[model samples]
Every structure is written in C-alpha cells, then in structure tokens.
Target: MGFSVAYETAELISPALQREMIAVTNELSSDRAWLSCEPPLLMNRGGILGGASKPNFSPHPDELAAAKAAGERDGTLSDLIQILCSVSSQFDVDWVISHDCSNGPLGCIRCGRCDPEVQDQCQVLSELAEELGGCDLDLDDL
Candidate 1:
C-alpha cells in the first residue's frame, strides 16, 4: 500500500509514537522476508486489529535511548491503567505489558507511566477512593 493509506491507518489508531513510527516506516528501503519475523521495533503500539491491514504494520526501532529519555519525563496513572487493561487479556502478557505504550485498540499516549509499582499504587488509590464514597474519577478527565 501507499504511504497515504498507512498514514491514514496511523491517524485512526492514534499511536503514541506516531512521528517515530512514521520515520521508521519511511526509512525502510524495501519489503523483505524478515519483515514478518523481525519487524521493526516500536516504543509503543496500541494493537493491530485487521489481518488485511497487516502489511501496514511498522515495527519500532531500537528505542532503549528513547525509553530512557521518556522515563525521565512525567506520566499519568491513567495511561498505565489503560495499558494494563489491554495486555491483561493476552496469554503473552509480558510482551504486551512491558512496552510503554501498550494500550487497547484506541492506543496509548506513551506517557511513561508504565511502571507496575506505580500502576498498583494507582489501583489501590482508586479502590480506596471508591470505598470512601468519592465519585468515580472520570477517565476522560485523566
């Protein structure tokens, strides 16, 4: 497919690393057999839906440096929670959960709040707040 179609899919998915993913895709020289087995690395992927759209999938680049920089920045508990929910359904949980931007079909914002400890703490706090008669926190507001 053309870049235009891929870009449209990216827009629809709202991936956290949109610019980076696009850059990686653009850098690709040609289609190869390795694409299926050794796809590019992505810092954060929302999740792919359609088999028909598989060719559009762009792997992420080596992002250790990027992840470190991202870790230094501030992130939100809500983002982590969303990521957790997305990966919980999968049998290969570690692969999906470890990424900084593993959200559901709607995708994540790669906010760097993917730490398990922090997510657990947020869950506890949310539960406590609910038990204490507080109004439910609106997800959209977070």
Candidate 2:
C-alpha cells in the first residue's frame, strides 16, 4: 500500500452548518489536533463559501507500518470522513467533490512508486486529462 492526497470540496446547505464547521475547526485548532500525515487540513479555504478537508499526504507508508507494528492503524480517507461525519447531524451538505490519488493529469503517473492505502481511489491522471476538454489552464498558474 501507498499514500496519496485526499481532497474534498463541500457545499454547505445552511448557515447553521457553516457555523458548526467553523466551531469544529476552532476545536481542532484548540486541541492542536492538526497533525501532519494524520489529521487532514479542514477549513473554509481558497475563498470557498463552504469548507474542505484536503489531506495532502495520507496513509503514509512509514506511519502505516509503524502503526501496524504497534497494533494501531494509520490515517486514511475514512479518517477524514469520520471527522466530517462527527458534525453530520448539524452539518447539511448538498454535495462534495473529491480528488484522491495523484494531483491530476498535470501531476502524478500512478507509478506505484509509493504504496497507496486506498488503491481504488488512485486513478491514472492522464485519463482525467480529457475532462479538461477545451479549458485553458496555464501550467504556471497551476
């Protein structure tokens, strides 16, 4: 298994959900629970109205092996999902856009160079290049 990034963009359906997410973010900060390689980055970022949790690098091989040896488990998408699910009752989300595996056609190659925890989530970036269709995306901007 290897590690890959997990990114999710959510659309909050209600002001109450936004407030709840903000509270959760505050709690995460206060608890100093925003550890790298484990806890994902959760917040309303990039001028997005709702929120997102983008785990840059998760299911880290070293961390996973260590945890396994220690009889524990490493972080995965499920971990990120659980964090959001905690506020599921109070959070009304209309939809969520998820991106896992490599960065995209402009990024990773699925070389298996890194053992991925969620192999199913990993996809060939080139296959997604078509989704860009006729969009003009400057490489430098990306």
**Top candidate by TM-score:** 2
**Total backbone clashes of candidate 2, pairs 3 or more residues apart or in separate chains:** 4
Model 2 C-alpha lDDT per residue in residues 17-113, reported as the tens digit of each score = 5556667745643432332234545455443333334332322346546656766544334444444444443444322324544344222112212
Which ranges of candidate 2 are over 4 A from the true structure? 1-19, 25-38, 45-75, 100-142
Give per-model TM-scores: 0.20, 0.37
Which regions of candidate 1 fall more than 4 Å away from where they truly are?
A: 1-16, 19-80, 84-114, 134-142
lDDT of each: 0.31, 0.40
Clashes (N, CA, C under 3 Å) per candidate: 5, 4
TM-score of 2: 0.37
